[model samples]
Target: MTTTIEILNPTFARVSGQELRKAPFPRLEEGTKVRIGFLNNQKPNTQELLALVESGLREHYQVESRTFFKGDAAHPAPPEVIEELSRFADVAVLATAD
Candidate 1:
């Protein structure tokens, strides 16, 4: 006997990646300290990866980080998580280790 399982995924109409080019990077004053929010995409080792990236950023920039959010395996960062991150961080690094 054999068994089969099905998985469903959300779909969106395809869009050109070029559309992203119009967005600009956020501006910060020289020497402005940056708070980085680290998001885990609910994957194994995500926290460790985020920590390493945070460490690297700290070595060169005025940086701090908080692991303030997590998401299920199939979803990206949640809106609430993003909102919270925006409140505390100038930039964010999302990590996934599947």
Candidate 2:
């Protein structure tokens, strides 16, 4: 008697490495004020969580500015909001609080 087996994976889609684009990661230098941007998904406790993160960073680094943008919870951020954030923030932190 012969037996056959089937294998399966949980992933629904596979993305090619060539299709991915890499963004530059900016390095923070000591003694220089860093601009921080917060993108909030407007979920519960997102604002509070971002605030806590901001406070933690401030305790260790010199922050230049804190820019906050609220985006829709179910959709991607608007282009205008992204543009504004890019203009003001050197680095961005996106929050999806539960």
Candidate 2: tens digits of C-alpha lDDT, residues 1-98 = 89988778667577765766787767777656888888888787888888888888887678766555565788778888888888988888855745
User: Whose lDDT is greatest here?
Assistant: 2
> In candidate 2, which residue pairs get closer than 3 Å at backbone N, Cα or C atoms, i.e. clash?
none
Give the per-residue lDDT digits (tens) of candidate 1, residues 1-98: 89988766568557776545543456766556888887777577777777888888777678777887665868667788888987997776755656
Q: Cα deviation of 61 in candidate 1 (Å)?
A: 1.2
| TM agreement with the true structure for every prediction | 0.63, 0.71
Clashes of each: 0, 0
How many clashing residue pairs are found in candidate 1? Answer: 0
